[model samples]
Target: MGISDTSTGILKGLVVIAAVFIVLAGLKTATNILVPFLLSVFIAVICNPLIAKASEYKIPKALSVTLVIVLFLAIALSIAGLVGNSLNELSQQLPQYRTQLNEEFAWVTNKLAEYNIAISSAVLIEYFDPAAAMGLAADMLSGLGGVMANLFLIIITVVFMLFEASSLPKKLHYALDDPEMRLSQIDRFLQSVNHYLAIKTVVSIGTGVAVSLMLWVIGLDFFLLWGVLAFLLNYIPNIGSIIAAVPAMSLAILQLGPAAAGGIGLGYMVINTVMGNMIEPRFMGRGLGLSTLVVFLSLIFWGWLFGTVGMLLSVPLTMIIKIGLESSEEGRWFAIMLSSDDDVEKYHTAK
Candidate 1:
């Protein structure tokens, strides 16, 4: 290419980068507004099936919506109560754990000293504060606190979204020129999202329950809190499972001996491996999957833009973008680039 052509292309790339930065900045700034709406959209998607099932029995739409909302509120309230009780107990018992934590720290320092690698207890304490692990868990809970604060707004938004969802296809038909094609694309996207959320919910619940049972059997403190963390973080790919395990494992080490802690860690690994690696893929299949790199990048990008809720919704949001891109004539190439090799090959083969 000519120098002038290369310069023009570079300028266009810079413009696109700047535009993306601006959009991200806006999203971060308006998080209070956007987070609720995004959450509502997801809630609406998840609850739509329940509403449909209720309606299939000739139930009125208002009654169906009310039934779904009531069920959702009951579940939310139960989780809130569990988490609140767990945190209250944890705060009261933290002083007891601190002594055990210090003992463990000393043991580690002594082990390192055996190799002629002397480390001071002060330095070790400074470097590894057990409270920090609790802080991490607290931060996750705090994020949930933010969501709970906005619960009413989110619920209202979901109710409206559900009502609009039924009429959306007709609205799109009149608004778009190629109504059939557009409706088909939208339907496919919704179906993909619904299926993914349903399967992921089941798998996450299984992981959480299994982990909680294992922790209980192993005599760990705050098993319910850890189980809830696992359920929530399981929404994020890769590092999420590790994040969920660290706090529980740290508590295990403090409460039990190293051997028991190791067993607890092993239990986490097996549960995550079985549920995330084995079971998820069978249900998710190739079509709904993103490239591994894309998954990581989406986690970082969305987390940066919208915080923890964004991280939780990252994969689904990226999937929606990919679906939208694939439906457009000019954007299909971008979608293909976001797909795994297997998916890319399938797309090409279909072409």
Candidate 2:
């Protein structure tokens, strides 16, 4: 007798689940090698526009790639050196900072007691500890510093990728059957990714610069380090800005005072509000189209799988999977579940 349709569907579902489990296992085991390759791909995508611009000016492809790589390498090395030194100093000073934070907490508790507010210092601390924020900052930056260990490999990979990027469309054109349909899908996906990253990178740079200037003006230590941190974490969405702000605010509390810390916090709010809510929306239109829950869940999941690099590249990696799923009819429903309601509405509207 032929297999029942329900039985066949259940078997196919099990097969899909098994395949995902195997793929995730492989990715986790290969993270050390995969992380650098992924970072290279990200760098290559961001640098492609620079190469294209140079090519438009009649620059040779090899020379243009060389120039772009050299420029990026110089900048990357400078950031690594600066951030490394800053991290070492910060790590050494963390105990002192924590002590000072405790003193601040005690002082506040005493002041509150004088007013008969009756809040226990321990309870207050349990609910709010700025030092914890500093620890998070340290962890995030250290992860970035770790990536620099594989700098040579990543740069070389980026150089080759950038060189290949120009001719990739042509290569695919001849290689794929049904070039019209397949190429169109691939082209749309790449274009969407490129557009999103390019805009995000520009906004991140602006956020970093604005943050550095604000902290510098407020006389906070490690303004540049904090600025770079802001630039990197700004990619994470929702919580990224909050995470970036805390360490700077905590440092301000230690080095400057509560007033300066408050100023730094407010500055962060303003910068993120303008960049994320105003500027990005104007430039990006509807943003990445992924739901908020999806971004947050992916952040934790990818972070677990790939460590820091995974967290940093979570959105892009998820987008790649989502778009790939979207390209196949069988997976379109899953893609919709991953997307924002607005995107779902648009999908149905288009249908």
Number of backbone collisions per candidate: 0, 0
Q: Which residue pairs in candidate 1 have backbone atoms (N, alpha carbon, C) closer than 3 angstroms, thus clashing?
A: none
TM-score computed on alpha carbons, candidate 2: 0.86
Q: Write the per-residue lDDT of candidate 1 for residues 164-222, one digit (tens) a residue.
A: 87887788999998899888888887888888888888998998999899998888989
In order, the Cα lDDT scores of the candidates are 0.86, 0.85
Error of 2 at 298 (Å): 2.5
Q: Across residues 1-351, which tens digit of lDDT does each residue of candidate 2 receive?
A: 256988998999999999999999999999889999999998887888888898789989899888888888898888878888887887788778767767878898899889888877778667656557677887887787788889999998998898788789888889987777777877666677788888888999999999999988888888899999999898886788889998888788877778988988889999999999999877664647788799899999989998878887888888888987987898999999999888899899989
lDDT of 1: 0.86
Candidate 1 worst ten-residue window by lDDT: 281-290
144 Cα displacement, candidate 2 (Å): 1.7
TM-score of 1: 0.92
